[model samples]
Structures are given as C-alpha cells and as structure tokens.
Target: MSGQDTSEVGHGHGHGHGHGHSRSRTVAGLLSRVGHAIRPHSHDTADKTDQALEASSKGMRVLAVSFAALMATALVQSVIVAVSGSIALLGDTLHNFADALTALPLAIAFSLGRRAATRRFTYGYGRAEDLAGIVIVLLIAASAALAGYEAVVRLMHPQDVEALGWVAAAGVIGFLGNEAVARYRIKVGREIGSAALVADGLHARTDGFTSLAVLLGAGGAALGFPIADPIVGLAITAAICFVLRDAAREIYHRLMDAVDPRLVEQAESILSGVPGVKGVGSVRLRWIGHALRAEVDIQVSDRLSLVEAHAVAVAAEHRLIHDLPRLTAATVHADPDGSDGIDHHAVLATHR
Candidate 1:
C-alpha cells in the first residue's frame, strides 16, 4: 500500500478460543498495567480510532496559559524600557511580545486540528500544526533580525542608557517569566509528544538567556562602558539566531515526514514479537502533528488462509499501537513468509 493513507486499519474477526492466562501481579507488573491504561494508549485493531486532537487539546491549554504569562512579562518590560530608555531592554521586550503572539497561531492550528476529516482532505487538519510550526520558525527569525538591527544601530550611534537599576530589574523579570513559561511548555509538549511545542519551549529558554544578557548590558553601561550594552544586545541576537536554525530544522523535518529511527526500530521490534508474525519487514512511522502514525509490513505463514492472515495482521497492529507511545494508528500489511525480499513477480505468479 502507498503509505499516504493515514486512516487506521480495522478488522472484525471473532476468534472462538478462550483460556485462563497466568501472569505475575508484582508491584512492577501492576504499575505497568495501570500506566498502560492511563496513558492515551491504543491497542492494535482498536474498535474505534483515537481522537487525533486529544493531544492538541492539551497543547491548547498550555498555549493559553503561556500566552497570558508572556503578555504580562512584555507589558512590564515595555514600561521599564520606556522609562529607562535602554535599547537592549527594548529589544528583549519586543521579542517577548512577539513570542507571546506566536501562541495564537498555534492555538488556532490546534483548534483546526480538532475538526473531523473531510473527503477532500483525507488526512484531516493535523498538518495545520506543522504549518503553525513554520510560522513559529519565521517569527523567531524575524525577532532575531529585528534585534540584530537594533543592536547594530545602537553600536553605530551610541546613546546614554539611563536608569540602569530599573533596566536590570526588568531583565530579571523577563528571565523569571520566560523560564517559567519554558518549563511549562516543555513539560506539556513532551507529554503530548509535540515537537513544535518543544521547539517553542526551547525558544522561550533562549529568551530567558537573552533576558540575562539585558542585565549584563545594564551592568556594562553602569561601568563606564556604554559599548558593552550594544555588544550584549548583539550577543542576545546571536543566541536567537542560533536557536532559529534549530527550530527551522525541526520544522523542515516534520514537513518532510522525517521520524526518529528509534521509533521505527521499536515498531519493528513489537511487530516481530507478535504471535504468528514470522518476520518483520518494512516499518514506516511519521508524526501527524503530535501523534504518531505507523505503516508496518509483516511476514506470516503463506499456508494460512486469508482470514487467518488478516487476524495476524490485526494482532500485530494492536500490539504496535499499545506498545508505542503517541501512536494513534497503524496500518499493518501482512505478506506471506519468505515472500519478502524476493522478486515481486514470483510471489504474484504463485498467488495467481
């Protein structure tokens, strides 16, 4: 199957064998069971597909709270910048405001992502998150450019930065605010498996460091070295630019459907472990927004009937969804054992 089909695979076969299975109920075992049930777990061949936006909902909550915090931070810093006339503080404040605004697009994307799939768009609106990711990368780039421009201008045209103490205090405020937001965003992003949100959290962390740079600028100005202020501002700009490279790379990978090799390996391992699966073949995994979707190829006995082969496929798929975190769906394609790696025509002819 061409892997573009993001739809989950399902089967309705009822096997008629039942028996009591023995298992240990150790503390670890009980905890494992509890964890498995608690997480947004998917058992392969799920009767109903998981709501793809469940994580997006969580993402929305995080973004909302962060947006408010950043807004307040920017407001306070803006007041300080106006009173102190510190160019460095001004740049940092502007960046904070810009960063705060980015949450809006991501929130919109998450909301759009919750909508049901349409006939024209078979994959639903999950790609909106990736699109929002692009917007976020661009915003980071723009913030860096603006900050850099301001720093270079100030360097060429030196200005007396007044109220060093207030500037320094505002810098601390920025750092505290950004660090708080960073911790929150990173925690929620990891829980929801969102690379975009994680990248944003990293951006916030960079902002916190830049805020510290503002304190350095203020100290330098107070030490009879006005040039240190612009230099520190430039340093802040450089930091933002450096992190922008990472954010852009992350977004590029997502747009290209690049996934971690470890996830692919894990899926293959689980598929091979499933009963009746003779061998694991190709395993492809990708992120549709924060959720993972997999396409697995398994080799099973050719001697089995079509119904039995399908059962094996369903079982393998169920195990994959259950074992893999953030796995929303899996499409398991069952091929006859030993048919893999052989000429396609040979297998086709035998079947014919």
Candidate 2:
C-alpha cells in the first residue's frame, strides 16, 4: 500500500480499470495552467513531418489537376462568349478563370509547407496554407465585384445575346467540367483535412451552378428577353458572394486556431481510457495546414515514480497518434496526485 510498491503495480497494469478513489479527482490543474502558459514540445517525430509532406503532395496534385480542368473549361467558354456576346456566359468564364488561378497561391503554400522547421520559424510553414486561403477569399471577392459591375453595366445598356445555341452549349460544358473538378477536390480535401482545398472545392461547386444559370439566361434571350442574360450574370455574382463568405469564414477559423470540438472530446476519451491515467485534464488540438497536433494532460497515482509516470505519458501519446485522424504529433504530460505531499510546483520554479 506504500508509494514504491503501489507504483510498480501502477506501471504494470497501465491499461487496467481506473482506480475508483482516484478516478473522481482531477490532478493536473497547476500542470494544465503552466503547460498552457509555457507549452512544451513532447513529440515531433520525423514520421509526422513525413506524413505532412505526403499530405502536401496530395494537395499539390489536386490543385494541378483541378487547375488544368477549370482552365480548359474557361478557355472553351471564352471562345463561345466572344461569338455570342452573352453577359451571363462572360461572367461565368471570368469566375472559372479566377478559380483556376487560386491554385497558384495554394501551390506555393504546399511547397513552403514542405520545408523543415527552422530556428526562426519553429512551427514550420504550415500556416502558409491559411495565408493562401486568405488569398483565395480575396480573389473570390474580386471576381464577385467584377462580375457584379459587368452585370449592372449590361443591365443599363442591354445588348442582343447572339448565337443563343452556342451560349447554351457553353453553359453545359462549364457545368460538366466544374462539377467534375468540384467532386474530386472535395473528396481529396476531406480525406486530407485540408480546409483550403475544401473551400476551393466549394468555389468550384458554385461555379458549376452558375454555369447552369447561364443556360436559363440563354432561354430567356431566345424568348426575346435579352435582359435575362445580365440578370443571370447578377445571380452568378450573388453566388460568388456566398462562396466568398464561406471561404473567408473557414480561413478565419484556421487563423484563430479553431478546431472541431469533437476532436477534443475524442482525445479526452482516448486519454481517459489509458490504463495508468487516473484522470484526464485539458486536451487541446489544432490544425496546422492539413495536419493536426495535440497537447494533453493526464493524472496518474502519486505512488508512481518518475519513470512509471513517464511510461503512462508515453502510452497516452501513442494512443493519440494511433487513433486520431490526421494527427501528426502529440504532447502528453503526466501529473502526479498529491497524496505523497511532494510539491511538483517546486520543480517548475527551478526551471523558471
């Protein structure tokens, strides 16, 4: 029942059921406070960095493929726009082109993300993706503004939308290409946990719908309502604004280091289930680019020696790395219950 003997049992049955008495009490209040104030790095393995690299590669490939597809679609639509002079078709073409160009900033971000952590930038360049997201949001806003302007001008001076059949064909072509790109981007983005890519995919999805709007405009023009073309252009502009709002919100969340609350819940559950952990403390998770990192605190019996306590912490870390999706690194701290009357805070003072 003494400290040393109990510690041996604690370490050996680290996966055993929780100690009933200790289960109800929290043990890491000071540790949690200090840990948050002065975060310590417990794990940053090369394998995690390699995983990040693989994610970046996947992102780059998505961007390259989608960019080519959207560009080709826009080029075809531009040719039709020149012949038909349909304002709706013209607005759709511009948005497709802008969406394609957004890939450039993301490409740069992925490349930067691959670079190793340096003394100057210890967290590495993963935040570059968030910055690229900002670039994308601005581009969407710009496209919306330009499209709106053109639509208003066209409304004031309505022109005959020529070659109605060709304009209608271009709409179908735009929808097909943009929709295909959207599906691929969204699928891969979710797989990799890439908000930027997901946002871009949403942008592409809207582009597809606006392309369909072009078809409606064509129908209106054929019925002698030429104003329908400019009106559809305005509709497309409004869709772009919605996309802009969504994309900007995503980037803002990332910049603020917001993560899904469910991740924190999952981490807590995993730590609580660790055999030696008497209780779980704060579990924090954040996204750096497409990857995830976590910092957690756990309480073990005060009977456990430093080595046994460390073993518990290591077990918690391993569980997190194994169970969490996209989690690249995790830091776990083991706090001791104060039954032994040994002051752990005294140790922190020495380090300070």
Candidate 3:
C-alpha cells in the first residue's frame, strides 16, 4: 500500500481503537476513504508545519543574540557610572543593570520555548515567552520606582555631580549601542511573531532615549543647573512607568485567552468555504506565544453518514491550518444541522 493509504489506516485505527470497535472489513473501507480524502493536501500541510517550525527556531536564535548584547552593554555602563560619581549616570547605570538581569531569564525562556512538546508539556514551552514578557514588565516598573525615588532624593538634597563630561560620554555610547540593538531585534522579532523579543526591543529603544536624557541632565548639571539632572531623572521614571502600565494590560488580556475577533472571522470564512460544510457553527482562536490554537464547529447535513462527517471535518481542519500562518493546531467538531438546538452561527456572530 502507498504511504497515503498507510496514514489513513493509522488514522482510522486510532479512532477505532478508542471506541473498541472491531470491524476489520469496515476499518479497511474507512481507511481507503480517508486516504482519498487526505491525499490532495498532504504535501501542503507538511510544508506549512515545516515553515512554522523553521520560523520559530530562527526567531529564538535572534532573541538570544539581542539579549546577550544588551546585557554586555548594560554591565559596562553600570561599572562606568560607579567610578564617575554622577547621579544621573548612576541611575542610568542601575537601570541598565536591571535590564541585564532581565535578559538572563529571557534567554532561558527562549531556549525552553523552542523545544518540542513532550508528555509533561502537551503544549510545549511556548507560554514561557509570555511569562518572560510579564517579568520584564514588572522589572521595568520596579526600575522606574527606584529611579523616581532616587531622583526625588537628589532634588531635595541637591548634591554636586562630578565628572560631567565622562558621564555624558558614557550616555552617548549607551544611546548608540541601545539604538542599534533595539532596531535589529524589532526587525527580526516582527518577522517571527515573537512577543518577548519585541518587548525587549522596545525596552532597548526606551533605554536609548533615556540615555539621551541622562546625557542632557549631566551636561546641565556641569553648567551649574543642578536641578536639570533631577528633572530629567523624573521624566525617565515617568516614561518607564507608562511602558510598564501598557505591558501589564497586554499581558493580562493574553493570559485571559482573549480571542482576536478578526482571526475568528477569518477562520469562519475559511471553514465555511469547505465543500461539505452547510454552515459554520462557531470559531475560536487563542494565542499560544507566537502561535495560535484554533477551534471551530461546523453544521453539516443530517443525511450525511458518520464517515462523511468525519471526512469533512478533517478536511476543514487541514484547510484552516494551511491557510492561517501562525496556527499551530486546528480542531473541528462536527454537528448535525439544527440538531443540538443551539444556534452555532448565532453564538459565533455574537462573539465576532
């Protein structure tokens, strides 16, 4: 028998085995039917799965590199500020150190996220990326709070800052380094659909902007306007707080499994286009890291046999997976037209 026939037999056997149905002749016939159903799209499905895996792997590698570079630059800045004795530089240095610390967890999360699903983790480690993003948000918030407090203290005490030129020079270096890394990460992250990498890129970009503020603050302090340093520090703190708030809101929505209405509509349109589907019942889509998990229900004729229904549902699943770029899995539950007394279309429409 051909590979297609073998795959069909395997699929039929899987379902039959679960139900403890022992009809050898019937199984053979069903397997042949499945083979016919699946043959046309087999190659396409395989290609899409391959592409998804490749893209995910490449994205993780880019994230690792970006995180490492950011950490190294942050460590150097921290050391420089410690020796220079400039409050604005010291604050910038501490912020960079915190950013460096966040990178370690991000690296681990990226590594875990790239692994295949196992018995212990049915969905793989994809959620690790999302969790890492949440941690980074919290870290940013903490950094902002610390900086704000320090800035306020400086404002009240009004201490003299030494080595303004050196501090400004370090800020310039940080600004350049951060801008380069941030732009690189952002470009790659969007291509691969990696939220964690994208968030880190934003963090790096923000750091670059804050570094400019630090430079200005130090320069102003040197020219005898000591208050400029404290004011700039306060501005940096406020920006960090704003970023943290937005990140937290996004994280909360994702964790709650909020479905994007547009994706649901897209899935519905795809499924409804299938030959045997009489109507689309419901469509649901959820994000699992950079990937999506989609579930759909369809209404078919009551006159159709169980085998026909199964075939149609399977075909729809295959089409949905192929059509949607980020979908990791697609499930279709078949329902007899108007049999369950639930208006599936109505439910889906309400959701949309």
Deviation of model 3 at 11, angstroms? 11
lDDT of 3 by residue, 190-295 (tens): 8866666677778778888888888888878878998888888888888777767777777787788776678888888888787667888668787777777766
Q: Please write out the lDDT profile of model 1 over residues 1-352, one tens digit for every residue.
A: 0112222344222121111334443334334533542332243223223434456778899999999999999999999888887878887987898889889989988887777667777666778888998888888888888888988999999988888999999999999999999999999999878888888998998899899889999999999988888888888888888888998899899999999898888888887787778877778887877777777777777655565566666666668767888776777777666545665347478667
lDDT of all predictions: 0.77, 0.79, 0.69
Regions of model 2 farther than 4 Å from truth: 1-47, 339-352
Query: Against the hidden reference, what TM-scores do the models get?
Result: 0.85, 0.84, 0.80
Task: Report the Cα lDDT for candidate 1.
Answer: 0.77
Worst 10 residues of 2 by lDDT: 1-10
Q: Which portions of model 3 miss their true places by more than 4 Å?
A: 1-33, 36-49, 338-352
Question: Taking the tens digit of each residue's C-alpha lDDT, what string does model 2 give over 245-281?
Answer: 9998999999999998988998899888877788887
Which candidate has the top score in lDDT?
A: 2
The order by descending lDDT is 2, 1, 3
CA lDDT, candidate 2, residue 333: 66
Estimate candidate 3's alpha-carbon lDDT, on a 0 to 1 scale.
0.69
**Residue pairs in collision within model 3:** none
- In the order shown, the candidates' Cα RMSDs to the true structure are 7.3, 8.7, 7.3
